[model samples]
Target: MAPPSVLISGAGPTGLILALVLLQNGVSVRIIEKELKHRIGSRGSGVQPRTLELYNILGILPDIQKEGAPIATMAKYNPGEIEPSPSPKLPSGSSPPQTYRTYPNGLSISQERHEEILRDQLQKLSCSVELGSELRSFEQFSDHVVAKIVKTNADGKQVEESTNFHWLVGVDGARSIVHKQLGLSFLGETQEEHIALGDIAVEGVDPRFWHMWHVPPKLLVLRSSSSTSKVFMFAYTGRPEHLAENPPTREEFIEEFYDVTGRRDITFGPATWMSNWRPNLRMVDTMRSGRVFIAGGSPFMSPSRPSLNTHVPDATHCHSPTGGQGLNSSVQDAANLGGKLALVHKGLAPVALLDTYSEERIRVIAHMLKVTTELYHKMFSGAGPADPSAWKRGSDLNMLGVNYCGSLIVFEDAAGAGVSSDAYSRAAGSTVQAAYCAPDASGLVRAGSADAPTTLFAVFHVSMHTMLLFGGDAGAHAPVATVLGRFPEAAVRTVLVIPQGQTAADDGALFSAVLEDQAGHAYAGYGLTAGELAVVVVRPNGVVGAVVSNARGIERYFQKVLV
Candidate 1:
């Protein structure tokens, strides 16, 4: 069967990332964006390391980090003084988020800068984002998926069209037209209180300083991640009822923003982006209603920073300026999804595996909501935090390196054995990725020969199966190879060799090819054990049938494959 060709909506970081990963894995994808134009205003100024790693996989993070300001150069505030919080760093061998450190400490590029990085990555994959197209409706059939699209002309006339695809991912965002068209319910809160947003350049402050005023009634958080002059500020008020018009005005913004900071000298002008963003705590009960999934800030919610219960660790309540977690969460979501899709394509995972995409994500997003919500209330709620000081610490640097505690797509490792984990397996668990693995000239280069077992255990895969021979002494198994070669019909090909102790120049050479190896015995199941160490892989469906190290004979093994 042919793999599904995916149609993705939205060109934000998440959508662009999904497109890049799918293309890399031999999957086809098309992206559609509703925006007819691009934004100059920056939003969501923080990016985290995990997100950067995902970009690394996509091959775009390095340039981005260089192009953007260093996290250490970005300002960090907690209390009396302001300083730069170092980039996010991660401690190895841990699952906690606290172990992770912000790279460049924490950056302050608006959403636009982040998107530029994503767009460039997409281009590297030979793909582009189609603009001014909206996914109005989509329907799923047993074998295919289709969507209704509305496109606007040069003169701004709207025209409707339909697109066909093998699958449709609605990264169309929270207010996704696709979500509504699919009759999927997006369940969450429209913030009960008040939140304000202002996008303007303010005077009377150094470009390098991240200012946080511990004011009562409202919190003033200002930081510049892009140009030094472009300062971002926010105000949270319980009395939003006393505020102005449907669409806000610059006059009103200057009044409210400056009043919160109590600085008449500081003036804001040339509003690039100005809108009231309410604090919403929400999530769709299901991210997939048929073939569409909801992502980004739309369906789910975000609370202002420096508040109570915010995923962020400090008490500043994330009110002023948050530079880390939100962007990190979205990038993480895309990485997890891509890996799962690869398993599905291989038919190595259970069908039910698909649903958990939403199940697990909800767990993470739920945490973000709680953390941000609490942080928002605490910082801006007036009665919440007594002081809005900025603080930076030598972080615990816990990397939120995600692991599949219960993922269904786990595969057997190199030894073709049930290698256990948690140190109790006595054998190392299979590595998550290996083929791309290149040998390192590290101190542990195994030069001494270890005995490799002749036969590996296997139950005939009704379809296909994998097997591995832990590297053992090649010289010890000549008789075995001879016995196996006795059956030329079983194209028993040896793929990779895992060496144990210090062995010869290790390049995964097979027994037949290497001179020191016992050529004849690979057939007899008389191979050696490498001081009891490394393992080698055997291709599935070998010509030879049952070659067991413990007891099976060469003749018997041949009979099984023929039968």
Candidate 2:
């Protein structure tokens, strides 16, 4: 009956997902949006594999897979050329089937539909976005935030209300009030190029391929929309002054489309949404200012203690829409902060855990900006679409390689062999390292039941940390049980994993569940040999919290994370 502890500004994917995570963890949340109605557009449509894994953890992967389509092959048309050349197969679009991954392909779904799915999930959780309600301003106190909210009434009048919450998060886009009020330095450069983007129906283009054209100093792309037939997401890059002076009208977009592509056969329809975007590559020096945080297109916030307040803002960082990392990164920002916020709110973890959100995200965001900026330059460098390097996307863009290695909170008792120094490069050789994205291993059958095989991802929960004991026998149970007894049973789920050819241990009384690695996929995925004793703690957010050798290491790792 009491008011929600968290106030989230901007009901976009970031805020909605953050609220979902908090609510799932039994943390109350109030989410608000400045927009009177949900916007319509196919913006930021690329859903990377890493994001799909996160969606799986949130119990929305089924919906996403149902509603989304695979990334379309690009059909490139050079200047004065009518016949299109298809882009070479690239690893960025999808990964081949592997035992260590579930969702290997990148998905293409409209941002509108993505947010709609997230909103639906929030509704099921007994929460809804307060539309037309804006966070006008907020003053952060030591323990709470006093926010001034402006609501637009049906009569077109604005009413102001003052409320207090334990935490405030801004998911409001680049011009976030939370970021402005917090006075964080948005350090980066604005590129000279400008782009016009919109969603429009087209009559003549093939729906199977993403059409692109390159004329010197001008580039245009029309990607098939996944959710709507005959509708395409349009993007045109041109001179800054030209795009700025000319608004994205239907007629103007149509004319530009023909002029750039040299295709008069395509008939353009009314645009559903349009925007003139400039590449503003910027990020906050710090994601938190006392009780305020920014995220989404910007920064975010969190509380340090039960008595303290926190703020998270949307638009903490904004970059070029090159690698499709905008929406994906923003959602990740929420995922990272949500678990910490929930723990802090419940008095289960110290407020210091909240600091790890900024620490982990800032490093990733900085690298992300650099990668996207490079990709942007490659796309518009006046090289024809035939330049393989310009169009070829590496596996890094999938975001499965993103990790929080070297984070203060993550503990690795021994160095992982063959781990890459550049943690953001690729997911292939980094599974055993702490702070990496947790790997998925199939062919895991429940103890004493091999009728239906399962996966490690299938048993992972959203609100609990999973401790995987690899190759543990009956003798190992006593020490593991003693260490687990020190923590709240509900907060951690212990699972004993038996390798192939080994007998299952009677650990039902000690562990929450037991899994048999029927095909050695579990051991292989974790970089362990058969019968090797190991402890791997997977955080609720699907990150490897620790890679330890014994029960003592497990205690040492959790001591830094939990209260």
Task: Provide the TM-score for each candidate, comma-separated.
Answer: 0.65, 0.92
lDDT of 2 by residue, 1-563 (tens): 76689999988788999999999999899999877777666777889999999988888889988989888777777755667865555354444333277677789997788889999999999999998899989998889999999999667799999999999998785566787787778788876655766678999878777888877677788887773568888878773355453336677778777787777877877677666565677888888777778777631111111110112223778776777888899889999999888887788888888899999899889899888878777777757455788766677788888988768888888855324556585535534667778888888887787469988888776688999888656776678778997888768888888887566545566878778888788887777765557888999899989888788889888888899
Q: Over the stretch 1-563, how does candidate 1's per-residue lDDT look in tens digits?
A: 44237888877767777777667656677888877764444556666544544454455657777666644232333333334234222212222221112232444466777778778777877788888888887788865777788987668999997767767777655556666666665554555544555556777666654555544545555656465545554444432465622324667667765555556767675666555555555555565555555554431233243221121111101122332455556665665565445445444544455675676566555555555555555555545444332222222211122232222222223254332222111122222212111111111112234444332222211122223344444553444545444533223333223333333343434333332223322212223244432222221211111324421333343332222
Winner by TM-score: 2
Q: Estimate the overall C-alpha local distance difference test score of candidate 1.
A: 0.47
**Global CA lDDT of candidate 2, please?**
0.78
> What is the C-alpha local distance difference test score of each model?
0.47, 0.78
